[model samples]
Target: MEVDYSDIRVIGFDADDTLWVNETYFREAEEKFAELLEGYETKNKIDQELFKMEIKNLALYGYGIKGFMLSMIESALELSNNEVSQATLSEILNLGKEMISHPVELLDGVEVVLKQLKGKYRLIVLTKGDLLDQERKLERSGLSAYFHHVEVLSDKKEKNYQDLLSHLNIDVKEFLMIGNSLRSDVLPLVNIGARAVHVPFHTTWQHEEIEEPKQKTGYITTNSLANILEYL
Candidate 1:
């Protein structure tokens, strides 16, 4: 498929999972928490419980370390019959904070692609996570210079994309979204009459994968970030 990015004045990209590694760290911590809760509940049972708690907490608390820590504490306490120690709760919260403060490592070829597109395109980083966490990562990665703007959203919905475009004074037809997920990234952009390109990540986060593609839209799929240069 040929993509005429020459008319695209602004190019927005997703941060976590799209530009850098995010879900892997979360999955690691969850596995450790599961081991800690082994005597209280089976792995499958714990995961199912945690999934429900995650959605609930996401609605109530939004995203980031606070929401994740709260969800973990709730899951642990419920599975342990409300007998979880204050010390364990403290430990879990500290771990979540640690994950945010951790190093920023870009995915393979992300830097290369960013370098290639920087001067030619109006690059913006549109990510959804805790504000501080996103800021810390951007500061550490030193890739912040490449972007014209950085937006940390509460969620990736059609409204978020629409609002962003309105704020920037750009029409949806003149913008392109590049990201790793079809669910949060591509589908929402397609909904707003914008173009999107999906660069599939190797490890899929449960919340990030889209089983069905949004139809009759300018959505392109690729296996790597470097491959996008051909279409552009």
Candidate 2:
């Protein structure tokens, strides 16, 4: 079924993978982290432990490189039974610092898509992460001027979308969210009577994965961010 996007007056974009290179850096960092702790555990074990620790620490720490850095440290300590050396810990911290300072690399066609839609709709950024880090990335991304507003949400749940839309005085029916995560960016908006377009990124964090509902109707999927321009 083709959903009408003719009513979309505001388009919310996800910041991370949807706009810039994000998960790739995390994947690279995880590899480096696993190599750092290779003496204590297998690479597979290191990956598993780090993911488990991250999930365990999500609520307490929220999301960002800082929380991920802490999770890596904790996972190392647990994997090595407190035998993990201080030098390794230092390296882990450095890994996160690298990610925080990494240059923002925008995805292909991101600028074109944004540029084409700039005057046609109210463009806004609705990403979930550390506010400071996200702000820094936006400043570095060189694309801040395109968005009417930017929101660094702690998370992207149904209530989060609801509150933001209501607070911004945006009509739910006229709002459309475009992003890389079905769980975070797509389904929540769809549940709130808002439209959504899922632009799947090449890589997705495990926690962000969800079973697509059999009754998907309020949203549509596109091969990439650029493809969404056709429907809009």
**Highest-scoring model, TM-score:** 2
The alpha-carbon deviation from the true structure for residue 182 of candidate 2, after best TM-score superposition, in angstroms, is 0.5
- Candidate 2 segments whose C-alpha is farther than 4 A from its true place: none
Residues 35-153, candidate 2: write the lDDT tens digits.
99999999999999999999999999899888999999999999999999999999999999999999999999999999999999999999988889999999999999999999989
How accurate locally is residue 224 in candidate 1, as Cα lDDT from 0 to 100?
Answer: 86
TM-score of 2: 0.98
Q: Could you tell me which residue pairs clash in candidate 2?
A: none
Model 1 stretches with alpha carbons more than 4 Å out = 1-3, 214-216
Q: Record all residue pairs in model 1 with backbone atoms less than 3 Å apart, i.e. clashing.
A: none
- Error of model 1, residue 92, in angstroms: 1.4
Task: Give the alpha carbon lDDT tens digit for every residue of 43-91 in model 1.
Answer: 9898888878988888888877668878999999999999878887777
Give me the candidate number with maximum lDDT.
2
